[model samples]
Target: MKEIMKDLKELMMKIDKFNSQQLNMLVEHIFDISNEDDILHLIH
Candidate 1:
């Protein structure tokens, strides 16, 4: 759980570093399409 949180934090930092609105919107769309279980499986 902690590892997953850590990984997610790292991923968010990387994403934020992009500083691109298009990329952010794409990521947001992906999240909107994904269910929680899908995300959990991805992190694992």
Candidate 2:
């Protein structure tokens, strides 16, 4: 879980310049995907 948190932090840093709407969409997409491999691919 700690590693996931680190990846999430890295992802947030990468998306820091995204607009509010884009960020919301990304967050929704992340939650919509129930597959662990897909989420890991996304975060990395």
Candidate 3:
């Protein structure tokens, strides 16, 4: 659970670094690829 929270926090930080338009595009791309069964699969 702690590792999961850490990862989530890191992801939030990454998102926070983007401009609004880049953030929107990043989110759209994430949603598009996030259906690949597992988050770990995407990360690796």
Q: Which one is best on TM-score?
A: 2
Cα error, residue 4 of model 3, in Å, equals 0.1
Off by over 4 Å in 3: 20-44
lDDT of each: 0.79, 0.89, 0.76
Sort every candidate by lDDT, greatest first: 2, 1, 3
Query: What is residue 41's positional error in candidate 1, in angstroms?
Result: 41
The TM-score of predicted model 1 comes to 0.42
**In candidate 3, what are the lDDT values of residues 1-44, reduced to their tens digit?**
99999999999887777667796886677788756675456557
Candidate 2 local lDDT, residue 38 = 96
The residue-by-residue lDDT of candidate 1 on 1-44, one tens digit each, is 99999999999988877768767776687698658887666557
Q: Which regions of candidate 1 are displaced past 4 Å?
A: 20-44
- For model 3, where is the 10-residue window of minimal lDDT? 34-43
Weakest 10 consecutive residues, lDDT, candidate 2?
A: 13-22
Candidate 2, number of clashes: 0
In candidate 2, which residue ranges exceed 4 Å CA deviation?
1-18
Model 3 global lDDT (CA atoms, 0 to 1): 0.76
